[model samples]
Target: MKKLVLFVTMFIMVLPVRADEGMWFLMFIERLNHRDMQKMGLQLTAEEIYSINNHSLKDAIVQFDGGCTAEIVSKDGLVLTNHHCGYDAIAELSTPEANYLKNGFWAASRKDELKPKSLYVRFFVRMDDVSKRILSKVNDKMTEAEREKAINEEIALIEKENNEGGKYTVSVRSFFQGNEYYYFVYQDYTDVRLVGTPPESIGKFGGDTDNWEWPRHTGDFSMFRVYADKDGNPAEYSPENVPLKPKHYLPVSLNGVQENDFAMILGYPGRTNRWMPSGGIEQNVKYAYPAWVESSKLGMDKMKVHMDKNDKVRLDYASQYAGVANYWKNRQGMIDALTKHKTAATKAKAEAEFNKWANKPGNKEKYGNVIATLNNYYSKTNEKARHDNYLVGLLRTSAFAALPYSMGRGLDAYASADDAARQQILPQLQAAIDEYYGNLYEPLEKDVLAAQLKLYATKSTGYKIAPYVAKIGAEYNNDFKAFVDKAFETSIFTTKERLGEFILHPSLEVLKADPLYLLSNDLIAQYRAKSDEQAELDAEFSRAFRLLVQGMREANPDAKYYPDANSTLRLTYGKVRSLPKDKRNDAKVNYYTTMKGEVAKYKPNDEEFDLPKKLLEMYEKKDFGRYADKDGYMPVNFLTDNDITGGNSGSPVLNGKGELIGIAFDGNIEAMAGDVIFDKDLQRTINVDIRYVLWIIDKFSGAKHIVDEMTIVK
Candidate 1:
């Protein structure tokens, strides 16, 4: 009975489709609680969000990769998103001394706020179901690669035909790997400006320690205003730039969430693991997260030791430390929660149960290695993820906006680079660096890469980049004496000088230089060159992944297959629920955390639990403004069964009425398996309600001009 219950629960956690006729009857029942998602929010008509045949969002949400989801909030060209999302823009315009990320940023007055050099948000001008357009070019007789090539050729011809001399980002999205396709034309404007953001202590709040876990109170958002050319066309920033009047905007809500209300998050969620095979789930439990969790823990321990014994290295990798440390602590809870739960063993049993019902004679070959194949893919995915993090996060993820910084880095390395040009890019890079790195790039690179490499080593046997990384890692980890000695050749430092002198300057031009800093840049440049090759590799990976998907389909033709996520609009509905994490209910508390629980758990000096003084004051005063939910004390944590990934951050979480209820942020601990498999019980998304955002803006930043643009609802 115990094993049966566990199996049932685990199967429900990962199932994506809600259907009664599926091979696994239990997967369908698990989705019953989340039926609200099938219909989306009650407030929204189906036509308002997705084009029924198109599987895309209606022209309301404009997305930018600048860590934000923007909406044309007012007809007067005003845009609204989380405040932290706009921090990079503000930082870009700030100076080293200006330190925008530390102080929180505000436009003060419109003329005073700095404009990002090349910031922009994209709205979908049109999206066509180009599936037929390309598929027709190939037939069943063609090989998989041949099919893709034919599709690519057709797509290019169609794009050239349909574009009619207009500019937009054209992308072809594939479903079920190569099963289906679609194309979109995006109107990308290059001019965007920083409008406002709360202080880091307010916006970041709990910071790294609290990331990904609930009872969460971080505002974790940013704000920016988009602009248009004089001709009402999207253009670069200019003195004459005017605010872009948007065609549509999401309305704010006064009626906030209470217990068990249905909610849905809508945005390009970055990634999720709703489709891992049972074996993949087992491997993650047995291998992936545990390995990563341990590495992160050890890396952070080393970081702490460095911080305690050496100030300069600590300061340098502050962001890196925060990031790795945050994930380390955060993931451990998830790993613990996942391992304690019966998800893996139960999933394997469920697969076996499904096999009993669906299996025919000689079926093993059809479903052969289904689990093992998924596990293999899971092991290799991190290599691509690490390579991407190195580029997008540290190097050029924010390229359009961070171009100046990237260019400046190039210029700095080559000293003869023009100052006038460098001057143009430097101010932007300087502030962005200050805001992002806090001038801590050198040490941060060492820390971030060190932790990442450790994980890479565990996941892939012959990881393509291992040879390159091993060479660097060995030298870096050898010891303080050897690492420092070999860090730079013809160096100037002696055993006598301070760490800062060695890092901040070459001791007398050659006294001390570090290989890590120079190598970090080299890796960045090296990877940028390899990125295209990676894309080709990814295309191959996708081919292999799709073959597995096809194998799964052939094994269970009736089993529904969802398309790979392409940062396009998608709607995944499930019930608001909690998972049972303990093996046998030792505590009797089905695990989930909330605001009251969060407040009670708060520990003053603990880095993760340290609340901002201002927030604490608000709580003390019972200053429940319109922002407070019926439960009181800003409903800081809420959950939903929205299938989301990274791009989903800042997504507008809506209730049955389509009213903005929460801003999607992190996934619950049970869901960390989400990067591999979303357990229905554990797969809830953590969101900060919209009311808190309004309250924070109205109360914290006091930005009335920005507030007035919204169509507030009660």
Candidate 2:
């Protein structure tokens, strides 16, 4: 009777409410979403979207570099993704003399393609529910630790069973706050090569100023090709490897989008905490994000100082600086939007209702304390959360702060090894050490580390601080420049030559005594330290939160529900839509932006908004060719109601007939709170229209052969 009630409750809860407000699993679309999608103009069947034994849309989508999404656009594995998604690889291949990032590069033929040392694209093969099998191993009486162990044992077996003798990678992911489980299988191709990109002025057009804001005119797309062995199996970089023959590739559409025209996006969205409680929301908005914003700005300011003076320094720190700036802006936006929306108060009201439902006679045992547990956990950890985020900022921006932890482990292994083992490890260790220093610009690094250390030490005052940092703070009065200078001068890890000598005569004593290593160890230990009582409370809180979700589903029987995103493939459908008219946008209609608006933002020789002379000349001459919209303007970027987040950076936005229309990249600033709560009115996905991508490749870059490889449908 109880099980039947739970089933009926879940069925009612999952009934569609808002059409544009979910990141839905592909596996559940047929039962839960297909009818609504069809009504909204999805011409493709659910089977056509995902099929294990057939060539389908799922075959074309891949997790790019384990972080972002990309799609195979040609039969020979020409992959399309956003420029920022390919930023690291592009930066790796760039040099001061022949800088591809400053001036875009297009491979004339397959022979000219450049490969990065480490880059991979993973194709999703299949997925299936394993909830029943895993859940059978745990019971209500079991502790969270025991429950975790039991589930992990089953997960390992399931992964091993499905791996098919090492041919595929398998992952068992928990969903619905551990209420369910599913296993995903994937195949990874490691030999992805860069084919083309726009110059930074176009690829990153508006830079930090225009990021996450609509009226966006950034041409934020890049191209790469996946290579495989002769049999079409994944392989490492080899001269003889050929472009992969993909199972399915999207047909690019020449027909432009109009308002209310049905649209959909598919990608691996990284994460969303839509199920997070009010206390957690309050903690992040009030405490954690503020620290993140401040620390990130500190790092960016210090890096930019040296980066502006030297081309080599700029090249070395470009990727890092861009990364820090993006999140710096994003966190501050979240703080503002959350505050503006009063998201915490809204969540609290809902929780108040849930608390009443939970305390009712029949529900008291399972859910009565769930809300209290969550509230207690958040309140206890608020200050620590702030402290941790500050530390996280340091870890992200300072190479030396993390280097001891990363490289010192190898040194420890060498110290303990026999003579033969030491010989085997020495070359690999030496190569890694050399690679570390090769990319590092020491003077800029010192400035960044000093600035970040000072910020972290001075600002992270709410709780116990890292002991070494505290000592340094007291000695230097919270300014770290002199200490960082002295440490850099004395630390063996500072240079490749010193590290090489230390490796020859490895000693645990020397590593322990090194000031840099000691500092790194102390920082890490402080972050991880927790009392036994706190650990118990955390465990109880985890169990209570999962029950809270389950109980909420039962209590709200008619409310809509979907699992939070966990870096898995999902499909979200909506339409090409517009918001209320705003003067910030140059578009007469708010749905799209054109080249004229982009050109208007340009400044002469400016880093963020500069335009190439050729581009400006072409725009002035009205030379967009066939890529222009029906209105005779060259569309740069467009807005849609499709749902997206961080990992959806390069997702393909498809029209009703499953034809590629645009590449989904950014989200509007007004809806920065979308991750915590979906706002149907304000949330919009900002995308670079496919036509703009083709215009740059065909007419501007003269890479017509590359465009010719695609399956274009008018």
Instruction: Give the per-residue lDDT of model 1 (tens digit) for 1-714.
Output: 975665445345434544211111111223332343444335554555554244223355677644456655555566656544565455555554665655666676667656765677877665666667677788756665687788888878767765658776777676666766777667787777777776666566676656675545666666777778767788777879887766556666788664456665556544444444555555555555555565566556655665656444443444455556655655566567657766566556655554443344565554444444445555656545444433333332111113332433433443433546645655554454444443432343344344444544334443354344456556566333344335423221111123224324323223113344444445455555555555555554555455555554554464344544557655455445445453322222332233454456557866445555666676778775777655454555456666666666677776676666667777766566555554454466777666766776777667767777777888
Give the deviation of candidate 1 from the true structure as CA RMSD: 8.2
Candidate 2 deviant stretches above 4 angstroms: 1-16, 557-560
lDDT scores in order? 0.55, 0.90
Expressed as tens digits, the lDDT of each residue in 475-506 for candidate 2 is 98876999999888888788888888887778
TM for every model, in the order presented, reads 0.71, 0.97
Global CA lDDT computed for model 2: 0.90
Instruction: Score residue 242 of candidate 2 by CA lDDT.
Output: 99
lDDT of 2 at 142: 98
Candidate 1's displacement at residue 216, Å, is 2.3
